[model samples]
Target: MTNSRGGKRERLASAAARVLHEQGVEKTTLADIARAADVPVGNVYYYFKTKDQLVEAAIDAQDSDLRTMIEALEAMPDPRERLKTMVGGWVDQRDLAARYGCPTGTLAAELDKRADGLDERIGAVIRTFLDWMERQFKEMGRDDARELAVALLAAYQGISVLTNALRDPELMVMEGRRLTAWLDTL
Candidate 1:
Protein backbone atom coordinates (compact mmCIF):
# COMPACT_ATOMS: atom_id res chain seq x y z
CA MET A 1 0.00 0.00 0.00
CA THR A 2 1.08 3.55 -0.68
CA ASN A 3 1.87 5.95 2.13
CA SER A 4 -1.32 7.85 1.34
CA ARG A 5 -3.29 4.64 1.47
CA GLY A 6 -1.86 3.69 4.85
CA GLY A 7 -2.52 7.16 6.18
CA LYS A 8 -6.08 7.06 4.91
CA ARG A 9 -6.61 3.70 6.56
CA GLU A 10 -5.34 5.05 9.90
CA ARG A 11 -7.61 8.02 9.61
CA LEU A 12 -10.54 5.78 8.81
CA ALA A 13 -9.90 3.60 11.84
CA SER A 14 -9.49 6.64 14.08
CA ALA A 15 -12.67 8.16 12.76
CA ALA A 16 -14.56 4.91 13.11
CA ALA A 17 -13.52 4.72 16.74
CA ARG A 18 -14.53 8.31 17.30
CA VAL A 19 -17.92 7.66 15.74
CA LEU A 20 -18.39 4.57 17.82
CA HIS A 21 -17.41 6.48 20.96
CA GLU A 22 -19.57 9.49 20.27
CA GLN A 23 -22.71 8.11 18.67
CA GLY A 24 -22.31 4.46 19.58
CA VAL A 25 -22.10 1.51 17.15
CA GLU A 26 -25.80 1.40 16.34
CA LYS A 27 -25.89 4.97 15.05
CA THR A 28 -22.43 5.23 13.51
CA THR A 29 -22.12 5.02 9.71
CA LEU A 30 -19.35 5.04 7.12
CA ALA A 31 -20.08 8.60 6.13
CA ASP A 32 -19.99 9.75 9.73
CA ILE A 33 -16.69 8.02 10.29
CA ALA A 34 -15.28 9.50 7.12
CA ARG A 35 -16.29 12.95 8.22
CA ALA A 36 -14.91 12.36 11.68
CA ALA A 37 -11.63 11.10 10.26
CA ASP A 38 -11.53 14.01 7.85
CA VAL A 39 -11.10 11.63 4.92
CA PRO A 40 -13.15 11.55 1.78
CA VAL A 41 -16.00 9.07 1.78
CA GLY A 42 -14.40 7.12 -1.07
CA ASN A 43 -11.22 6.66 0.96
CA VAL A 44 -13.12 4.71 3.62
CA TYR A 45 -14.30 2.12 1.11
CA TYR A 46 -10.81 1.89 -0.32
CA TYR A 47 -9.48 0.69 3.04
CA PHE A 48 -12.56 -1.05 4.41
CA LYS A 49 -14.81 -3.21 2.28
CA THR A 50 -17.66 -2.64 4.72
CA LYS A 51 -18.56 -0.70 7.85
CA ASP A 52 -18.26 -3.84 9.93
CA GLN A 53 -14.74 -4.26 8.65
CA LEU A 54 -13.92 -0.73 9.68
CA VAL A 55 -15.32 -1.25 13.17
CA GLU A 56 -13.40 -4.49 13.48
CA ALA A 57 -10.18 -2.83 12.43
CA ALA A 58 -10.67 -0.01 14.90
CA ILE A 59 -11.55 -2.47 17.66
CA ASP A 60 -8.56 -4.64 16.85
CA ALA A 61 -6.25 -1.67 17.12
CA GLN A 62 -7.64 -0.74 20.52
CA ASP A 63 -7.48 -4.32 21.80
CA SER A 64 -3.87 -4.63 20.69
CA ASP A 65 -3.00 -1.61 22.80
CA LEU A 66 -4.75 -3.08 25.82
CA ARG A 67 -2.87 -6.35 25.41
CA THR A 68 0.42 -4.48 25.34
CA MET A 69 -0.45 -2.81 28.63
CA ILE A 70 -1.50 -6.09 30.21
CA GLU A 71 1.74 -7.70 29.09
CA ALA A 72 3.67 -5.10 31.07
CA LEU A 73 2.03 -6.28 34.27
CA GLU A 74 4.27 -9.34 34.09
CA ALA A 75 7.27 -7.14 34.74
CA MET A 76 6.05 -6.11 38.16
CA PRO A 77 7.42 -8.54 40.73
CA ASP A 78 4.61 -8.54 43.26
CA PRO A 79 1.27 -9.96 42.24
CA ARG A 80 -0.63 -7.85 44.75
CA GLU A 81 1.30 -4.77 43.76
CA ARG A 82 0.92 -5.78 40.12
CA LEU A 83 -2.84 -5.95 40.48
CA LYS A 84 -2.94 -2.60 42.20
CA THR A 85 -0.64 -1.09 39.61
CA MET A 86 -2.85 -2.38 36.82
CA VAL A 87 -5.90 -0.79 38.33
CA GLY A 88 -3.91 2.32 39.18
CA GLY A 89 -2.85 2.50 35.58
CA TRP A 90 -6.47 2.42 34.62
CA VAL A 91 -7.09 5.28 36.98
CA ASP A 92 -4.15 7.15 35.54
CA GLN A 93 -5.75 7.01 32.13
CA ARG A 94 -9.00 8.30 33.51
CA ASP A 95 -8.84 11.05 30.95
CA LEU A 96 -8.79 8.56 28.09
CA ALA A 97 -11.76 6.68 29.46
CA ALA A 98 -13.49 9.93 30.29
CA ARG A 99 -12.99 11.07 26.74
CA TYR A 100 -13.45 7.85 24.77
CA GLY A 101 -15.84 5.82 26.92
CA CYS A 102 -13.61 2.78 27.54
CA PRO A 103 -12.61 1.39 24.16
CA THR A 104 -12.72 -2.27 25.23
CA GLY A 105 -16.22 -2.13 26.61
CA THR A 106 -17.39 0.13 23.82
CA LEU A 107 -16.09 -2.18 21.12
CA ALA A 108 -17.46 -5.24 22.87
CA ALA A 109 -20.88 -3.66 23.01
CA GLU A 110 -20.62 -2.67 19.37
CA LEU A 111 -19.47 -6.12 18.33
CA ASP A 112 -22.67 -7.46 19.79
CA LYS A 113 -24.59 -5.64 17.06
CA ARG A 114 -22.65 -7.23 14.20
CA ALA A 115 -22.61 -10.91 13.23
CA ASP A 116 -19.38 -10.70 11.26
CA GLY A 117 -17.21 -12.59 13.80
CA LEU A 118 -15.97 -9.45 15.49
CA ASP A 119 -16.94 -10.63 18.96
CA GLU A 120 -14.66 -13.65 18.88
CA ARG A 121 -11.76 -11.69 17.46
CA ILE A 122 -12.13 -8.96 20.08
CA GLY A 123 -12.80 -11.56 22.76
CA ALA A 124 -9.57 -13.32 21.86
CA VAL A 125 -7.62 -10.13 22.38
CA ILE A 126 -9.34 -9.56 25.73
CA ARG A 127 -8.79 -13.16 26.80
CA THR A 128 -5.14 -12.89 25.90
CA PHE A 129 -4.75 -10.02 28.37
CA LEU A 130 -6.94 -11.60 31.01
CA ASP A 131 -5.08 -14.90 30.71
CA TRP A 132 -1.80 -13.13 31.23
CA MET A 133 -3.08 -11.44 34.37
CA GLU A 134 -4.55 -14.70 35.59
CA ARG A 135 -1.22 -16.41 35.08
CA GLN A 136 0.41 -13.84 37.31
CA PHE A 137 -2.13 -14.52 40.03
CA LYS A 138 -1.79 -18.29 39.66
CA GLU A 139 2.01 -18.00 39.83
CA MET A 140 1.58 -16.20 43.12
CA GLY A 141 -0.31 -19.31 44.32
CA ARG A 142 -3.75 -17.84 44.02
CA ASP A 143 -5.76 -21.02 43.37
CA ASP A 144 -8.76 -19.18 42.06
CA ALA A 145 -6.86 -17.62 39.21
CA ARG A 146 -9.76 -17.87 36.79
CA GLU A 147 -12.21 -16.32 39.18
CA LEU A 148 -9.69 -13.68 40.23
CA ALA A 149 -9.04 -12.79 36.61
CA VAL A 150 -12.75 -12.45 35.96
CA ALA A 151 -13.15 -10.29 39.05
CA LEU A 152 -10.16 -8.13 38.16
CA LEU A 153 -11.44 -7.48 34.66
CA ALA A 154 -14.90 -6.86 36.01
CA ALA A 155 -13.57 -4.38 38.56
CA TYR A 156 -11.73 -2.42 35.94
CA GLN A 157 -14.77 -2.47 33.70
CA GLY A 158 -16.90 -1.29 36.59
CA ILE A 159 -14.40 1.45 37.37
CA SER A 160 -14.45 2.62 33.77
CA VAL A 161 -18.23 2.63 33.73
CA LEU A 162 -18.53 4.42 37.01
CA THR A 163 -15.77 6.88 36.20
CA ASN A 164 -17.48 7.80 32.99
CA ALA A 165 -20.83 8.15 34.69
CA LEU A 166 -19.65 10.05 37.74
CA ARG A 167 -16.62 11.90 36.34
CA ASP A 168 -14.80 11.24 39.60
CA PRO A 169 -11.24 9.94 39.28
CA GLU A 170 -10.94 9.43 43.02
CA LEU A 171 -13.97 7.18 43.08
CA MET A 172 -12.35 4.94 40.52
CA VAL A 173 -9.10 4.77 42.49
CA MET A 174 -10.85 4.28 45.80
CA GLU A 175 -13.13 1.55 44.52
CA GLY A 176 -10.32 -0.02 42.53
CA ARG A 177 -8.13 -0.35 45.64
CA ARG A 178 -11.03 -1.67 47.62
CA LEU A 179 -11.74 -4.28 44.97
CA THR A 180 -8.07 -5.09 44.47
CA ALA A 181 -7.72 -5.79 48.20
CA TRP A 182 -10.82 -7.93 48.07
CA LEU A 183 -9.54 -9.90 45.04
CA ASP A 184 -6.17 -10.67 46.69
CA THR A 185 -7.95 -13.12 48.96
CA LEU A 186 -9.29 -15.10 46.00
Candidate 2:
Protein backbone atom coordinates (compact mmCIF):
# COMPACT_ATOMS: atom_id res chain seq x y z
CA MET A 1 0.00 0.00 0.00
CA THR A 2 1.00 3.58 -0.58
CA ASN A 3 2.09 5.80 2.34
CA SER A 4 -1.21 7.67 2.22
CA ARG A 5 -3.16 4.44 2.25
CA GLY A 6 -1.11 3.06 5.13
CA GLY A 7 -1.55 6.32 7.03
CA LYS A 8 -5.30 6.26 6.50
CA ARG A 9 -5.46 2.64 7.65
CA GLU A 10 -3.48 3.42 10.74
CA ARG A 11 -5.70 6.40 11.49
CA LEU A 12 -8.81 4.28 11.08
CA ALA A 13 -7.41 1.59 13.35
CA SER A 14 -6.54 4.16 16.01
CA ALA A 15 -9.95 5.82 15.83
CA ALA A 16 -11.62 2.44 15.95
CA ALA A 17 -9.65 1.56 19.06
CA ARG A 18 -10.71 4.78 20.77
CA VAL A 19 -14.34 4.31 19.78
CA LEU A 20 -14.24 0.68 20.85
CA HIS A 21 -12.92 1.67 24.26
CA GLU A 22 -15.51 4.42 24.68
CA GLN A 23 -18.67 2.90 23.17
CA GLY A 24 -17.71 -0.79 22.96
CA VAL A 25 -18.02 -3.13 20.03
CA GLU A 26 -21.81 -3.45 20.13
CA LYS A 27 -22.35 0.29 19.90
CA THR A 28 -19.37 1.49 17.89
CA THR A 29 -20.15 1.92 14.20
CA LEU A 30 -17.87 2.17 11.20
CA ALA A 31 -19.15 5.66 10.52
CA ASP A 32 -18.24 6.67 14.05
CA ILE A 33 -14.69 5.46 13.54
CA ALA A 34 -14.47 7.02 10.10
CA ARG A 35 -15.64 10.37 11.40
CA ALA A 36 -13.21 10.20 14.28
CA ALA A 37 -10.42 9.33 11.86
CA ASP A 38 -11.48 12.17 9.55
CA VAL A 39 -11.60 9.73 6.68
CA PRO A 40 -14.43 9.33 4.20
CA VAL A 41 -16.88 6.70 5.37
CA GLY A 42 -16.76 4.95 2.04
CA ASN A 43 -13.00 4.90 2.15
CA VAL A 44 -13.12 2.84 5.33
CA TYR A 45 -14.13 -0.11 3.19
CA TYR A 46 -10.88 0.18 1.28
CA TYR A 47 -9.03 -0.54 4.51
CA PHE A 48 -11.35 -2.96 6.32
CA LYS A 49 -13.97 -5.03 4.60
CA THR A 50 -16.10 -5.64 7.67
CA LYS A 51 -16.79 -4.33 11.13
CA ASP A 52 -15.22 -7.48 12.56
CA GLN A 53 -12.08 -6.85 10.57
CA LEU A 54 -11.95 -3.32 11.85
CA VAL A 55 -12.48 -4.52 15.39
CA GLU A 56 -9.69 -7.04 14.95
CA ALA A 57 -7.44 -4.26 13.72
CA ALA A 58 -8.26 -2.29 16.85
CA ILE A 59 -7.44 -5.28 19.00
CA ASP A 60 -4.16 -5.72 17.16
CA ALA A 61 -3.34 -2.08 17.80
CA GLN A 62 -3.99 -2.54 21.49
CA ASP A 63 -1.90 -5.71 21.54
CA SER A 64 0.97 -3.83 19.96
CA ASP A 65 0.64 -1.21 22.68
CA LEU A 66 0.73 -3.90 25.35
CA ARG A 67 3.91 -5.32 23.83
CA THR A 68 5.47 -1.89 23.81
CA MET A 69 4.55 -1.36 27.46
CA ILE A 70 6.04 -4.71 28.44
CA GLU A 71 9.21 -3.89 26.54
CA ALA A 72 9.53 -0.67 28.50
CA LEU A 73 8.94 -2.48 31.77
CA GLU A 74 11.70 -4.93 30.84
CA ALA A 75 14.15 -2.06 31.15
CA MET A 76 13.64 -2.09 34.93
CA PRO A 77 16.37 -4.18 36.56
CA ASP A 78 14.08 -5.56 39.26
CA PRO A 79 11.00 -7.57 38.41
CA ARG A 80 9.10 -6.22 41.41
CA GLU A 81 9.81 -2.71 40.28
CA ARG A 82 8.64 -3.65 36.83
CA LEU A 83 5.36 -4.86 38.25
CA LYS A 84 5.01 -1.69 40.26
CA THR A 85 5.78 0.31 37.16
CA MET A 86 2.98 -1.52 35.37
CA VAL A 87 0.62 -0.50 38.13
CA GLY A 88 1.89 3.05 37.92
CA GLY A 89 1.26 3.06 34.21
CA TRP A 90 -2.31 2.09 34.89
CA VAL A 91 -2.54 4.80 37.48
CA ASP A 92 -1.35 7.27 34.86
CA GLN A 93 -4.37 6.32 32.79
CA ARG A 94 -6.75 6.50 35.72
CA ASP A 95 -8.92 9.16 34.17
CA LEU A 96 -9.33 7.24 30.97
CA ALA A 97 -10.00 4.01 32.86
CA ALA A 98 -12.59 5.76 35.00
CA ARG A 99 -14.38 6.86 31.89
CA TYR A 100 -14.13 3.72 29.81
CA GLY A 101 -12.89 0.96 32.09
CA CYS A 102 -9.95 -1.01 30.67
CA PRO A 103 -9.81 -1.01 26.92
CA THR A 104 -8.68 -4.67 26.76
CA GLY A 105 -10.85 -5.92 29.61
CA THR A 106 -13.98 -4.24 28.33
CA LEU A 107 -13.37 -5.51 24.84
CA ALA A 108 -12.71 -9.03 26.08
CA ALA A 109 -15.81 -9.11 28.25
CA GLU A 110 -17.96 -7.75 25.46
CA LEU A 111 -16.54 -10.09 22.87
CA ASP A 112 -16.71 -13.09 25.19
CA LYS A 113 -20.38 -12.48 25.70
CA ARG A 114 -20.93 -12.35 21.96
CA ALA A 115 -19.60 -15.94 21.60
CA ASP A 116 -17.80 -14.89 18.48
CA GLY A 117 -14.77 -16.66 17.04
CA LEU A 118 -12.76 -13.62 18.13
CA ASP A 119 -12.35 -14.95 21.64
CA GLU A 120 -8.85 -16.27 20.91
CA ARG A 121 -7.86 -12.95 19.43
CA ILE A 122 -9.17 -11.11 22.49
CA GLY A 123 -7.55 -13.68 24.75
CA ALA A 124 -4.20 -13.00 23.15
CA VAL A 125 -4.47 -9.36 24.08
CA ILE A 126 -5.01 -10.23 27.75
CA ARG A 127 -2.58 -13.14 27.69
CA THR A 128 0.19 -10.81 26.61
CA PHE A 129 -0.17 -8.83 29.82
CA LEU A 130 -0.73 -11.84 32.04
CA ASP A 131 2.19 -13.72 30.55
CA TRP A 132 4.48 -10.77 31.10
CA MET A 133 3.32 -10.42 34.67
CA GLU A 134 3.85 -14.12 35.21
CA ARG A 135 7.34 -13.89 33.83
CA GLN A 136 8.10 -11.06 36.20
CA PHE A 137 6.80 -13.02 39.16
CA LYS A 138 8.78 -16.04 38.09
CA GLU A 139 11.90 -13.93 37.81
CA MET A 140 11.26 -12.98 41.40
CA GLY A 141 11.41 -16.69 42.22
CA ARG A 142 7.82 -17.08 43.33
CA ASP A 143 6.34 -20.56 43.02
CA ASP A 144 2.87 -19.06 42.78
CA ALA A 145 3.89 -16.70 40.04
CA ARG A 146 1.01 -17.72 37.81
CA GLU A 147 -1.49 -17.24 40.59
CA LEU A 148 0.04 -13.93 41.55
CA ALA A 149 -0.12 -12.74 38.02
CA VAL A 150 -3.80 -13.67 37.83
CA ALA A 151 -4.52 -11.92 41.10
CA LEU A 152 -2.77 -8.75 40.02
CA LEU A 153 -4.59 -8.63 36.70
CA ALA A 154 -7.88 -9.40 38.43
CA ALA A 155 -7.29 -6.60 40.88
CA TYR A 156 -6.63 -4.20 38.03
CA GLN A 157 -9.73 -5.24 36.11
CA GLY A 158 -11.89 -5.18 39.23
CA ILE A 159 -10.66 -1.75 40.21
CA SER A 160 -11.15 -0.53 36.68
CA VAL A 161 -14.76 -1.69 36.68
CA LEU A 162 -15.40 0.14 39.93
CA THR A 163 -13.62 3.21 38.70
CA ASN A 164 -15.72 3.38 35.57
CA ALA A 165 -18.99 2.59 37.33
CA LEU A 166 -18.34 5.04 40.13
CA ARG A 167 -16.77 7.67 37.90
CA ASP A 168 -13.84 8.01 40.28
CA PRO A 169 -10.35 8.13 38.85
CA GLU A 170 -8.85 8.31 42.33
CA LEU A 171 -10.03 4.76 42.95
CA MET A 172 -7.49 3.51 40.44
CA VAL A 173 -4.76 5.66 41.93
CA MET A 174 -5.54 4.34 45.39
CA GLU A 175 -5.52 0.80 44.09
CA GLY A 176 -2.21 1.39 42.39
CA ARG A 177 -0.68 2.59 45.64
CA ARG A 178 -2.10 -0.40 47.46
CA LEU A 179 -0.79 -2.75 44.80
CA THR A 180 2.61 -1.14 44.96
CA ALA A 181 2.69 -1.57 48.72
CA TRP A 182 1.58 -5.15 48.31
CA LEU A 183 4.32 -5.74 45.76
CA ASP A 184 6.90 -4.39 48.17
CA THR A 185 5.82 -7.01 50.66
CA LEU A 186 6.32 -9.87 48.20
Top-lDDT candidate index: 2
| Maximum-TM-score candidate | 2
* Candidate 1 ranges with C-alpha deviation above 4 Å: 96-100, 180-186
Q: Report RMSD (Å) for each prediction in the order shown.
A: 2.7, 1.0
Clashes of each: 0, 0
lDDT digits (tens) for residues 1-186 of candidate 1: 598887888778877776787777778889899988898888777789987888787777777667677668767777777777877777787776766657778677667677678887777877877887788778788888888788788878877887778777777768767876775665
Per-residue error (Å), model 2, residue 116:
1.9
Give candidate 2 regions above 4 Å deviation: none
**Backbone clash tally (model 2):** 0
Of candidate 1, the 10-residue stretch with the lowest lDDT total is: 95-104
lDDT of 2 at 113: 81
TM-scores of all predicted structures: 0.81, 0.97
What's the distance in Å from true for residue 74, model 2? 0.9
